[model samples]
Target: MEWLPHAQRLAREVVRPESRWYSAVATVPRHTYVPRWWEADGDVWILRDGQSNPDAWLKNVYKDTTLVTRVDTCHADTAGIEGIGIISDGTPTSSSTLPSLVVRMYRHAMIADDHQILVTTGTGYGTALACARLGSDHVTSVDVDEWLVNIAQDRLSLMGERPRVEVCDITGPLPGEYDRIVATVSVPRVPVSWLQALRRGGRFVTTLAGTGLILTADKTADGGAVGRIEWDRAGFMPTRHGADYEHPADDVWKGAMEGEGEATSTSRYPLLYPPDAWDVMSMLALTLPGIDYRHSQDGDTRTVWLLHPDGSWARARASGFLDSPAVHQSGPRRLWDELERIRHRLNREGALPVYGAQARVDPEGTLTLSRGAWSMTVN
Candidate 1:
């Protein structure tokens, strides 16, 4: 099994040539940690096991792609045997994240030869890579899921790169202080505890929840950090407090899908999919936190939907590519108008001002993002 060589080649394409972690990326066997995984087949998720299909498994494992190892509380390794088509639905709770993105976050951390770092332990593949690069003594990995921590600890011990792998809530008190902190999971905002835990001059990197906005900052003497959102994009699942994430109720889902209208209007532009346009999406996610978005298209017709926790829901549809969508919104707030306001600014500015913009985290955990005169706060 010369999968190591193929994995190394994939690394060269994703990681910058100057990265010192290249050897770590090359040496770690990603497949060992993700022997069985879940992948979507049409609308259903199918379990893929390596023992039954080693060749296809090897090919998928070597490529820079996320492998879902657990759905809710079900670990793919223990779920069943080869190619089980699960007709039921389960949200993905854990995965071996794409290697390129993990390395990107590591590079963003500006890891030194001596700096201790704390990172998330997903399937333990990333922890293994970090341990190889920074040595097990300098690496401390934590996760909120006890099962994840237990599984990752056993795997890391097998590789002989055992660091302090703990089942600690990453949003809560950390097990120890470190010079660098990089999280694969997105947080609502920079945790106040993280600032207290970071050594002075320590750097932190993580994404903002609901958007692919990756923020990095250095710990300041004022107890808050300052930095800019990188032009590079990255995203991961939100941090959960329990075995599974909270979802909207069945009635709520129905209302969000097709609720009665409070206000209605013609859209100014073609209904845009937020994920397709990152800048507009960033502004939308920041301005309107907890907005659930969905989109679909059929031939020439396109549809967009928005749902807010405040009982606001919106649906817009366009008959042609260039046509403006007719929007029908329900609930307290006009969600579609918010999107238009962001889209209008994006249309005028030619770029969302998130990149290279100044960001400040106050001691109380208020995050202020400013560019030129435009400013927004997340508290």
Candidate 2:
């Protein structure tokens, strides 16, 4: 099947025709990088083989949509043709990010002709796009999974491209200095290794784990960095040290799901899924880091739970869209009250302080984000 026209259509949808990145998006065969992928079906994952349905493959591959390539330890490629309808109990580990977002990220990097860039190698599609914009010699892609690196390298080789593909953890020491560092994966904080590996005055763009923040900063002469949280927001899976993410114990989830709380009250607002609202999620993440969110529904009733590692928990339930939830809170902090406070602030002030906040990173990778008189630090 002819896929060039579809790629061109995607390019037009993502970037201007006059944009320098246009040709790369217009020409690269995205289908080659993603011959198989995993699609979400309610609570389980359904594996898709492109060869099985060429039309569906072209329809999906050329669109501006993210395609999940790996779920936990299960890769779509390794899954057999009969792997359709496979029930996956794990979260998405890697994916071919949507084309528009990839272009936006590269635009944030302000990559120049001579700039040497380090990017994430998820499905190799993003890396391929980078190589298309800058020569293969100017791009380097890295991943924590050796298999991913090896396969990405093989795929790139098929296109007569040989950018540096390595299997080192991105959070650890990098192999070389770069003019720009762009990560599609989110990190807890600015990795110290990234600070050291970026040349002075170099710029890096990344998102923080557990928040929809796009932090773009530059290296400083003093060995630290200074920049700001961008007005644009994005979210990515957090960096993993191994093949799979370390999930909270089942017992911990049970407690958050079923355990009684110390306090109960009527919530100020209707039941809202915090994560569905980017600003609310970001503000909550900034105020209370590592808070886990869970939701469940039974017929007419809907329940949402917020769990923090600090032993704080909040449960809210409602039956209607406009119904105020009965909120229960427990532990050292009143998690629900804090969430309400953030919402109240947004409702009254019109915005959260996290957007376009000034950012400063100490030499040790500590980040301080301040807006107006509000300041928060992440170490």
Candidate 3:
């Protein structure tokens, strides 16, 4: 399609140099994998297809963005050749992750041509880039869905290159040893299986489940890999064994949103909406692990909810677009206080040390980060 040139331009200008990975962004046809797609609108996935409006699809596809290709592992192919039908209703199980994010993760991966690498293959676009840079023989790409693997294999073959495209869950035992392993998907923990499959001195890059932290570490002789956060923030769909992510606690958001009942506490810091873009949120997550945030905006009121695994939660709301907000919190830990503390550290020190921090992982899966005298341990 004529749109290919535009996609190439966006890839070259936005994703290539910024991420420093091989420019598969220009080579792989992202539109082909996403002939029809969906976007999250509130609680539902709104189906959008190329055939209906080629102009709109062209613009959306080439914007250096991610399109949800499938939901609940149901391929968009079920909607017929033109990609029209009932929009599948469920969480996004897989996608061609945004090109910028893909490149960023690859940059964090620090892959070299001589090192054999294992990478997660979904739409196979990432695998194509790996094969292009490292040679097909040096890259082993695996995915849990055989159909995805097969389609990706065909796509790669069309380009005169073929890496080992196989149907295997990335969280399990990999087929071969490699000096580098990069997972496009997030995982609950550094899958022990990955550490076991990595050769000594190998490096692995992945994201922690439900967080935007990119964990990069090198495989050790003791079988554990040690590394630190890349200092850049990234997010990916969590890894799944079969198809979809394990369901989160039902009504978890519902209960928190309703403001059923709770004791109140003064927040140690000012609350911010959409913490994903805030460096302090990342720092707070690292400093006080297991805290998650949710935000809601309805008419004049904007509310933010913080939930932790330790049964701690905080709800803050502001009216009339005021600069300050009223907050209420409960549980064993002062969640917002911790966030404010992190923000205070950032304010005083000029920046948090997460970026460019050093990491080390022992054989037992314990991960440690160090920057001067400040250190944090993650398991």
Candidate 4:
């Protein structure tokens, strides 16, 4: 119980004032749902349990981090009973998503106190927060996994609060009309069923699959919705059909770590950490949806690769500290040049107009972005 005070302090100081809603929600004991978990180390998953080391377990459980709760829809508690050294290489199916990202998502949703909310129930921690802020009667949580629904019910009961926690696939028609719908997972596109379930003027917040962009839109009178990105970045696991994400091609990212190119001159631009934060990556993804990026760092050397479904490829490498980077690219179109174009636009325009950009969604699910006279449409 002593840890509760410390966790609350961290949530308030490190998370709350900084606008991290997930961290405040993390004050709830994540270890309750994740008494055992499997950590990913490259291609392998290692199981860690509460009984193994008390101090280490406590440290990890409350560190404002996300813990993988299930792999391929198989809960860790069941998987661990088999034995140790059992490798589960399947993709992560469910998790207590990181608190900072969760909070960022909620902030984008802009839930009002009296709004009726429908939220995805994974660990139920997010559900608890909704109930804490907006009252249990105002929140309805759903999960496709019945076990999770039951577990969340029990946990909510333990906290002396009750909301309608049910087993329903969110990809399909939801049970009730809601003023705010916040999904903790990503979706390929906004499902029409969600629009059918939303009240007029209701707002929905979600992320696009395969990218870090968050989509926030308000329901419109004509049965569609339109909203723009907030001034933030977030990513989440894609929405699942049954219980997990479809397996990605194993060889898709294979051999990317080999770093097969010559060292280049230092780039004019300073090397960015977590290259996804770069505006170029976001623009590239918007312009070309299926392109994938991989980055690796070893000592003083850094390499970035861009691969496309059409076999177009680009690689950039830098050795030591340098300003102007040598770039190597080959494909239908020069990828580095495209990045340079985006960067140039960013510099000349002083900002890439993504956040607060105008969005219009048609009833047919087409999304169009409009800024000034320039526009891009996504189907």
Across 1-379, the per-residue lDDT of candidate 3 in tens digits comes to 5866866786776664545353567666666656777777767777777878988878887777787777885676454564554454477888877777877777777887688888888777778778766789898899898878888888788877778878998888789888888998887667788888888888899987656778888887778776777667777887778766554433345555656436665454455753654566666766666567777888877788888766677778776465466777766776766766776787799987767778877776777778888887777
Clashing residue pairs in candidate 3 (N, C-alpha, C atoms within 3 angstroms): 225-361, 226-360, 226-361, 227-359, 227-360, 228-359, 231-355
The alpha-carbon lDDT assigned to residue 131 of candidate 3 equals: 75
Worst 10 residues of 1 by lDDT: 248-257
Which predicted model would earn the best lDDT?
2
Q: Is candidate 1 or candidate 3 better by lDDT?
A: 1
lDDT by residue (tens digit), candidate 1, 263-298: 778987876888888777778889888878877788
lDDT of candidate 4 over 90-135, digit per residue (tens): 6678887766566667777888778899999988877877777678
Candidate 2 overall lDDT versus native: 0.91
Let me know the TM-score candidate 1 reaches against the reference structure: 0.95
Candidate 4: segments with Cα more than 4 A from true spot: 14-27, 40-44, 71-74, 84-91, 144-147, 167-169, 247-274, 321-337
Over all chains combined, what TM-score does candidate 3 have? 0.85
* Model 2 residue 22 distance off true place after TM-score fit, in angstroms: 0.3
Best by TM-score: 2
Models sorted by TM-score, best on top:
2, 1, 3, 4
Write down the TM-score of every candidate: 0.95, 0.97, 0.85, 0.80
